[model samples]
Target: MLLKEPRLNFTDVMNRKAQEKGIQLDNDQQRLIRHLETLAETLLRRRAAFAGLYLWGQPGRGKSFIVDSFFAALPLAQKKRAHFHTFFRELHQQLNGQGLDAALLELMGEARLLCFDEFHLHDIGDAMLVKRLIALAIARNVALIFTSNYPPRALLANPLYHDRFVPSIALIERHMTVMALNGPRDYRQQATGHGVFSEGAYLWPASAARRQALGLPDASGAVALTVGHRTLHAASSPGEFLHFTFAGLCEAPTAVMDYLALCEGHERWFLDGVPPLARVSPAAQQRFINLVDVLYDQQRRLFIAAACPLTELVAGVEQEDIARTASRLSQLTTE
Candidate 1:
């Protein structure tokens, strides 16, 4: 009898993960898994003509879940996975003195497959950089895989400046096979029944009693958090929970790495004085969006006292991205 080939496809791995995690694979997820399996097979074979994949969908649609599983199951060794924010932060730092080509070489060293999670476009500077990076990566035959909340057309959604990013958008459309994971269920919301941390771990309009419950002190004072060469001030630092006013955390020129460090150092976070989304400047609003993404990805518990409910917290600008933040916030408990 002939020996059977090993079942190493993306679908097989995802199905095994579902079984291990006690999750039932939905039809939409199964379809995505099949597509990813094909992509993985091509990459594993190092096909010269293979293009990359760009997976996008609404928040909680399992785009990240499926892509993460596919990346983990790939048998190749020259692969790198990074959250887009973290990747860009490092990329920008590396590109300060070095040219784009040199930066790409250093960043992509020994990595033929680049997997970027939560891919997005906002700043014009980043857009220009990404456009060149995409061209170079494609030319060098690096297989790209991205999971994002927005499609290529919807990226850099600033109405007045959207056209400026057309080149980058065009590059993505031309080089990557865009797929949408339009699943019906919002898995994050569905998981809320399990418990806060296991489900969402978000609290909105945090009340006085809730603050006391979390062991926040009656008296609050400023505390300094040192990240690298910079010192960030928090409104309150009681025990393991670090508290910040919305302005203090998002309005300043705070780096993504600072928020990442906070997430790593503390078990819980508290944000007070969260004004209506419309009230904040566009830059600050963007910072808040980034904060939510980092917090959600890190699975850190968040407590916030907001001026409006989550539904009304999102402003008209960047509605798609802010909607994702709102969706993730919904998983958290509100008093």
Candidate 2:
């Protein structure tokens, strides 16, 4: 006896998930779903021959949501999805004792389709690695899908050194179809009063009520969370919320994996003493930006008590990326 192949009904799966999540797909979202359905069918018929998709838009525009829906609907066994930071962290670890090509092949394993969320380039070192990785993945005929806040030209948009990534950009353009999810609605802001953290999510200037809601008792003791070989200490850990000073989480030598572990461990997170961008070191600012990216990608709720409004948080070289963090912060509900 032979088994039957699963039905390739992307629309039905997407509609079901949307209904369960109480999401009303907007016109732009529906159009993207249609495109995803078409891509899914094409890939199903010709997995190796099909080119993939590159989706770009501003933060909170539902790029991740749409891609996630499509990825979840795919019935193939050879698909893998991961946040870009996590993927690269693991990639670097794999590269320590092996060549780049060998490490990429190992990382991909038997996966034919790879979905990367929050794809962007900032570090020169990472750019070099990604160029190699892209070439290798395309050579292996891996169908690639990515969600990013930047289109191809805007990636690493510094005028001083953007040309270094031209080869990678060209490869991407040749192998993938780029589309923008330029929707009118900012779904993150529209998510007010929806989740457990919605009640007292965003708190600025550290008011007494905010302190109380964050469970910051005067006699609270220090708490620590261990991730891999490193331990992250918090100022206080009371009830479901873990509280930290801005310096403790971002200014410290914390990595993306540490932020991911923190999100996994705590239901609610509170960060106090968030100084203005002018006051933070460039390194600390970058860490803060990465922290925000992790939290947003994981859909983890955070309560921030900052010195100034979100708009005035970063004023230095990282102003562009920090602006995205501030946008996400503003969308969260405040007490």
Number of the top candidate by lDDT? 1
Full-model lDDT for every candidate: 0.78, 0.76
| Model 1 bad stretches (over 4 Å) | 1-7, 18-28, 192-201, 315-318
Model 2 agreement with the true structure over 1-335: per-residue lDDT tens digits: 87774556777777887787677887777877888887777667655674678899888788887788778778778899988888888888898888988988898898878899988888777888878877777787778898888898788777666899888899889888888887776777766443443443566666887678666543255578677789887877545666788888888988787887667677667777888867878778888889877777666667777787666665554555765676577766654
lDDT of 2 at 127: 84
Least well predicted 10-residue stretch by lDDT in candidate 1: 194-203
Inter-residue clash pairs, candidate 1: 202-332
Candidate number of the best TM-score:
1
lDDT of 2: 0.76
